[model samples]
Target: MSSIAIKFGIGKSTVSDIVKSKAKLEEFQTEIDDGDCTKKPRVVRKSDFPELDRAVYLWFVHQRCKGTPISGPLLSAKALQLYPRLYPDNPADFKAGTGWLRRFKDRHGVRCLSLQGESLSAAMMDVEPFREKFLKLVEEQGLTRHQMFNCDESGLYWKLMPNKTLVTSREKEAKAFKKPKDRVTIMACANASGSIKLPLLFIHKALNPRCFKHIDKNDLPVHYYAQKSSWMDSYIFKEWFLNRFVPLCRNALREKGLPERALLVLDNSPAHPDIVSNIYRWIDNMSLLATQHYIRYPTHGSGCS
Candidate 1:
């Protein structure tokens, strides 16, 4: 052992230990190699069936479609619950489960590709069909630019735009004097014959009948003005339209000396009691003032906008 160590430049103790271990391992190998040893071929368990894996993947896909973020561990747990016969083993195979899910998603395009609601994508897809219907309606309704006037209420925040340009500290400090509270301005406009009416601008803490009192029977056109308002469950909408909106339209039309065959385009909103009562009374009385020149219903405002 000492001679061997010197030849190999190793310590005698290390050389003896290595030789003894090698000899012991060789003897063990020779014994194992004899008939006493039967080396059955090692068997590899096949991965879970593709169909089961695909089903698990689909489950995750559905959850994700509904805005749920399903991680691999969660999916594996779910699989165990759903298919105990298949996933009865340890959940450490979560990586394999997630891999199957990813494969299924890629193959079938089952993942949601939209950031917005599914309805938004559906609406976008329906645009072309909607346009075709709109054209048909326009023809059937005999709508011309002169006959159709667009009216919409828009809101504006009354404040100087926040300066985007970087300002020195001194400049900001100078302008730090208390700024006025921002105000919301609601304005409505009607356009006809290449002319737009002087916009009706009002600042109200909220939209209500009182806020719209300025619109009386004097500001409307005789022909239909396509006015748009949202559906809010309040009488204010009816009060504004019946008492203020329609009257203003009539008065404006009278002032323009145009005939009263005006159509008011409004969404289906429940009228306030006052407006509903007024409408009922007008209908009962069959009064000329109650007679609408024309009222056109809109399926939607896609083309109108």
Candidate 2:
């Protein structure tokens, strides 16, 4: 061996060690082959898939776009099933699905289907200053001046809960579920004065204008319907404000002791008729009383109104 190593320009000890290791390995292989303890083929676990993390992110995006409720186990199962279709031969392993989703959610701030209490807290923090300013304005204006009212329409869905419920992590937890297709209209008016009135009518179908049919000359108390594209027609504004909102405002002043020159605020929605016509009419009609009252905050002030 030493003579052969010298001739090949290699160290004799290095060659000998390699030969001895090979012999030992061969002997071990023989012993294993002769024994009943057969070596099992190594299985690639879900964690072995190189692209499992990427697959989980894609799945999450898909579900969010579709407005689907998602969870860790569900996402993992979905990723495993979809991996084969999306990546073919390099599908993600099933076992790593949950871990990938958890990591993805932590890194990206993906919210679950149901909002958590912490979310409400975050929103409150953002709006707290606005609320404080509003309260101060109300205090300065007095109850009559601040007569804040909110008018909006809500959809009453089938099996809707009357109140919000708490959520828990228990399996088979009771969830508030409802049929989305069945819904009814519920228009309501409420004020900071603690007065609330339900609309006299409710529409069984969403788009039916029949609920608004009764809002004619007799019921025009400062018409407050949301502006729609159709209301932008040449004569719609004149017809609505001149015939409706003005008359209602006059009547409200008489009945509610609202100042004759009360300010009327509204959004700058395209559907809104130009303020010039309405202002002219109010000034012409109310004269001196209109001096103290003028529409202020013409843009984005509808909420306060």
Best by lDDT: 2
Task: State the lDDT of candidate 1 residue by residue for 72-163, as single tens digits.
Answer: 45655665565645666744554435665544334333433324323322334545764575456447555444433444433455665653
Worst 10 residues of 2 by lDDT: 296-305
Q: Candidate 1 — which residues are off by over 4 angstroms? A: 1-122, 129-134, 165-181, 192-198, 201-203, 206-233, 254-258, 266-305
lDDT of 2: 0.46
lDDT (Cα, tens digit) per residue for candidate 2, span 1-305: 98889888999897797576786556545634754222432221223444655566666778657645566667667666766875676543344445666544444445455432222223335356645654554465443542444433344576555546566767456556653555554444433454323232233432326666655534643333333321233244445445543454455555666654433333333434465323424443642111111222221111100
The positional error of residue 111 in candidate 1, measured at the CA in angstroms, is: 29
lDDT of each: 0.45, 0.46
Error of 2 at 200 (Å): 8.6
Model 2 TM-score on a 0 to 1 scale: 0.32
TM-score of each model, paired residue for residue = 0.34, 0.32
Model 1 residue-pair collision total: 8
